[model samples]
Target chain A: MSAPGAVVAAPEGLHDREFGPANAGKVGMWIYLVTDAMTFGGLLIAYASLRRMGNWPDPAEELGITISSVATFILICSSVSMVMAIRGAEMANRKALLGWLGATIAGGVIFLGIQYYEYNHLVHHGLGFTTMEHGNNLFGSTFYAITGFHGLHVLSGVIYLTVIWIKSLNGRYDGDASHVEIVGLFWHFVDLIWILVFTFIYLL
Target chain B: MSEQSHSTKPYLLVWIALAVLTGIEIWAAIAFDGTAKWATLVALAVAKAGAVGWWFMHLKSEYGWLKFVAILPIIAAAYAALLMAEVVAR
Candidate 1:
């Protein structure tokens, strides 16, 4: 099997680290994301069990779903932008690449902003990692843990994308987009995980 | 790389599908209750995840061990669910 981070070395005729016919580096990212999914899944499974075990608060009534849904839409849009960035990278369209990547980063930062507001709203209402006024008052801890972890991923993605955007401006991704596409994988994974988290934590 | 590999049409379609599913998810959460609501919401979430994974993430084009590696989590989740169910049953 090929080594992690080094998907089959540079082809004989090609220069170093250039993607081969398969762009297997993207696949490597996918594999990494799969493992990341399991980590989130385990945390979620524990959360589900906790909700079942406790007299948890009504998700709809206690937590703000409308804003979260809006945040969800923003992240979804970021995913779209991420794909556009990948396409731009693959086609070597620097303008489109940088533009779409900037849009994605903006979307992520906005998401974080909305989340910060949501967390503040909840905390002001007396719900947080250590305290809760609603049913299953202990639910606050798990709620924060799950969402906070996902929030950190968004923060990281934003930083990662900002770097990519800057480098794109510098012509780093002109000939090859293996790096941008990989970052897109991570960004899309964050979006995908939010889908599951939104359903399980907020909607369901 | 194939020229066809760099298209945006499929990504747009997936994005639209995801948006529509999310709309349905919010509506289902409001419209239904009990097990039906949970089922509908979960089903929609799964569909959205699949679209993102299959299209945006390009798992559809990946194959072999790469594919298996990408799919490993679902298998593990299923196993964990069964184990948890058994323990709960006891």
Candidate 2:
């Protein structure tokens, strides 16, 4: 595979690094994200199979689209904030970096709050983990399994962003923005996964 | 460190496109029915995911092998989706 920037031949006696023109940390994160994607993919496939087996209720009726759509919009906004944070790091603007990173973290916190509220509302309406009043129990099971797993991801992402934000405040990324870029990759992946989850679990 | 210049315009444009596609997705979900609805929603979701991967995740600026690394799971997911189709067709 061709490297991104201009290619230069190594001097006669020197061996080049394994990952040419790519940061090792970035590649490692990509690998981790691939595995995580597969996990979500497996869960979604199973959910679809179970859904196709019949006796499934309409998701729109059970889970209101309005609230979830709001959550989805918030995630998309957070993704933009993440991009800005990376840009800030690249430009070595500490204030911009901290501001955008804080915004991203706030977005995550709000998302989790909305999820908690939604879960509580669902449970109050009789959509328990193992039982749903006047509905198939599997709906509750698969719904929570997929969404709850994603919720955990969001929760972790918030924590991850918080750590990165704290480090940014400490000037850890002033000279090198690679770590911020790596964390940005993880954040964007979470948002990407949510795009799919929203469609499959809430809209479909 | 060498100074580098980056533009936020592209990112902003991508954000606008994503937001518009999401709005269309919601409308399609409410207005469309059956196969049309499912197809539209899936297509919109994929488009949104692609935008995030390409622009936000910087895949467009990545190396060839890295792009390959990113696409590996998509192939796997497609296979899994095919299995779901088979089960659904049964």
lDDT of 1 by residue, B1-90 (tens): 356354777887788888889999999999999979977997898889988889988878765566677788889879878966875676
Q: How would you encode candidate 1's per-residue C-alpha lDDT over A66-164 as one tens digit per residue?
A: 999999999999999998888888778898899999999999999999999999989999897887776675588888999999999999999999988
Best by TM-score: 2
Where model 2 places Cα greater than 4 Å from the true spot, the runs are A1-20, B1-6
Isolated chain A: TM-score per model? 0.88, 0.90
Alpha-carbon local distance difference test for all models: 0.84, 0.87
Question: What tens-digit string does per-residue lDDT give for candidate 2 at B1-90?
Answer: 233233887888899999999999999999999999999999999989999999899888776577889999889978997898899778
For candidate 2, the lDDT comes to: 0.87
Where is the poorest 10-residue window by lDDT in model 2 chain B?
Answer: B1-10
Model 1: runs farther than 4 Å from truth? A1-28, B1-6, B87-90
